[model samples]
Target: EAGVVQSPRYKIIEKKQPVAFWCNPISGHNTLYWYLQNLGQGPELLIRYENEEAVDDSQLPKDRFSAERLKGVDSTLKIQPAELGDSAVYLCASSLGAGGETQYFGPGTRLLVL
Candidate 1:
């Protein structure tokens, strides 16, 4: 089976500029998530989607960040007016989210905000 896909494995941008990343989750999976992981820390979930519903998004920085999982398949995360501290790896994961299973993570998109 195919795995999750992400783009711009690496990125460098000036602070206060806008940036965006994309993700494609695995087939047959009903749950998708977007997470931000610092250089030396574990992933912190930004959003969780079950199909087209955003079941959780409490950790997202709404002031300058936004995300969406459309059609319950693909997802996109955007940062407006990025800041130096926004530099981190954006990880995407998917799972059945029903019977308790491990989440499969993608390679991730690393952002370097200047």
Candidate 2:
């Protein structure tokens, strides 16, 4: 089976521009996560989805960021009017369930906001 799928591995845009990232998690996985990693920092969970429901999203900036997992399969994350501080790597990961199992990660989407 496939691991995970992400598109546009890299993106560059000026501040105030909108950017979006897409992810398709591993098949049969029931838990999906979106994380943000700044340079030299560990990945921080921005949101977590159990199937099609967002179970954890306290860390996600609601004003300019939005995410959705459709039909419990694929997911998309968007940042509108992005800021320079948003420059980072957006990582997508998935696990079998919400049991703290090993998670498979995708080749993150790197974004640079000038």
Candidate 3:
């Protein structure tokens, strides 16, 4: 998959800069996830954490991106020295738990690295 996709809803920035996105999930939700979506594609899971412990992060790009769930209520995703290929829509979702529960997604953070 391409590292980034173009879109009008965007947070514009120069390449090699740092960027961060935040998400606040609904009350009582304990499972948080971060995803990336390119144009015309479904969101791809990047990381998932339960109550501040990362349970799934095999797809996350650790060298450039990092994520944390503080107190299991709010989450943050940060990219250091973000590259041009890092532009895309970042999605945040949360569920009551890690199984088949309905996940609530936030309005994604669209990034455009120039």
Candidate 4:
């Protein structure tokens, strides 16, 4: 089975510019989560989706970041007016969501800001 898919694998943008990242979760998984990983730090939850419903997004920066799962399958995350500090790895994970199943992660989208 194909694991999560993310693109460009890397990105370079200037501060204050808008950028977007895409994610395709593992097939048959019902829970999807987006996370931000700063250098030397563990991934922190940005948002989570249970099918098409966004069940958790309390950690997302509402002022500049937005995400969606239109079909309850694939997802997209957007950062508008991104700041220099926003340069980090955006990871996408998925799990069966049954009794603390392990979440599988993608290679991650690496963003660089000038």
Question: Candidate 2 clashing pairs?
Answer: none
lDDT of all predictions: 0.91, 0.95, 0.83, 0.93
Total clashing pairs for each candidate: 0, 0, 0, 0
Model 1, residue 19: distance off in Å is 0.6
Descending-lDDT candidate ranking = 2, 4, 1, 3
Q: Which residue segments of model 3 deviate by more than 4 Å?
A: 1-9
Q: Flag clash pairs in model 3.
A: none
User: Worst ten-residue run, lDDT, model 2?
Assistant: 95-104
Q: What's each prediction's TM-score? A: 0.95, 0.97, 0.89, 0.97
Q: Flag the better candidate by TM-score, 2 or 3.
A: 2
Better of 1 and 2 by lDDT: 2
User: Best by lDDT, which number?
Assistant: 2
lDDT over C-alpha atoms for residue 24 of model 1:
90
Comparing 1 with 3 on TM-score, the higher-scoring candidate is: 1
Model 2, position 25: C-alpha lDDT score: 95
Per-residue alpha-carbon lDDT of candidate 2 for residues 16-113, written as tens digits (9 for 90 to 100): 99999999999999899999999999999999999999999999999999999989999999999899999999999999997759989999999999
> Tens digits of per-residue lDDT for model 3 on 1-114?
111211223588999899888887777778888899987899999999898999999999999999888787788888998999888899888888976798877778899999
Compared with the true structure, what per-residue lDDT tens digits does model 1 show for residues 28-108? 889999999998899999999999898888999899998888788998999998999999999999997845777999999
